[model samples]
Target: MAIPNEALRKVLMEIEQKSIQSSQQIQLVKAQIAAKKRESRILQLTASEVGVLPSGTAVYEGVGKMFIQTPPSDVMLRLEKEGSDLKNDVTNLEKKLHYLETTYTNSRNSFEQILTRAGGSV
Candidate 1:
């Protein structure tokens, strides 16, 4: 038996809401990935600039509002580790964004199909 139009319309509305939520989540993840990419680039540039310094040169790293003298090698190592962590974060966020996008597409398709089956347009 064919489902009632009212029921189908309700389901369609719910799916539409879900699709919108998924789209928002995808946007948030994309923003996070972009921010991480920028941070990683900054770290890389800082490391490159540090590479040109003499071995005896003092390096200072900012901690909160204070800057403490740090070894150049230590600074380089820390920057490398931070960059790696940021890269990993971006990768994970990308995967999450992909999942959200797929979910959103599926929800949208289902919403369209339901609307069509109900002989309606929104």
Candidate 2:
């Protein structure tokens, strides 16, 4: 059985649209990774200077729209943990984005081949 040109065209269009959406998602994920990396760098820097601050030094932590006084030691530990979590999240997102891109490319190529066989321009 042979597929119709119209059906092939529709499938190709759908695949192209999905590819575009996947590309957009990848860009968003990349931006998130960049932001997370910046945050992680700042945290690492702060953690490195943990011994410099005086015991009585004042530190404020942001909680929503309010800032609460917090211990520097507590802040240092929290920052290190949060940075590690963000790094892990970025890694997982990168893997997912890679998979999406690979699948999108394969689907687009297959659709293009079908369209070509149907005497249609991709």
Candidate 3:
């Protein structure tokens, strides 16, 4: 079987674009995770310095104020949920990318096989 040059080129181009988009999305997710993780770390340090539970839940008192330090825990939970969603999104993107790349490779291989059979004649 042979694939037309135009079709092959189109698939290859689409594959490249999809891969680039996926990569960019993965990078964005990583950046978001890093930001959230940094905040979590800072929260941990602050809690440690001020005396609080590291499990993100505990009762503590601050200077002239008896607060339950819930902001960090709340933010951490929200960020963690977001991170989980992004990780799942990345996994889906990777699967789509693999499919697209495989399509391109199969088309290119078919073209090559055609060329070989035709003795390199257009």
Residue-pair clashes per prediction, in order, are 0, 0, 0
Whole-model lDDT per candidate:
0.89, 0.81, 0.58
How high is each candidate's TM-score?
A: 0.93, 0.78, 0.46
Task: Name the lDDT value of residue 62 in candidate 2.
Answer: 84
Candidate 3 ranges with C-alpha deviation above 4 Å: 1-70
Instruction: Please report, as a residue range, the 10-residue window in candidate 2 with the lowest summed lDDT.
Output: 113-122
- As for model 2, its CA RMSD to the true structure in angstroms is 2.5
Give the poorly placed runs of model 1, Cα more than 4 Å off.
none
In terms of lDDT, the best-performing candidate is: 1
* Cα deviation of 79, candidate 3, in Å: 0.7
Candidate achieving the largest TM-score: 1
Q: Give the clashing pairs for model 1.
A: none
Predicted structure 3, TM vs. truth: 0.46
Candidate 2 lDDT over residue span 12-69, tens digit each: 7888888888778878878887887888888888877764889788888889999999
- Name the lDDT of candidate 1: 0.89
Q: What would the per-residue lDDT of candidate 3 be over residues 5-121, giving only the tens digit for each residue? A: 676566556656665665566566556656656665665555455354455555343536556445555545554666566566656656665665566566566656655775654
Error of 1 at 9 (Å): 1.7
lDDT for residue 45 in candidate 3, whole number 0-100 = 58
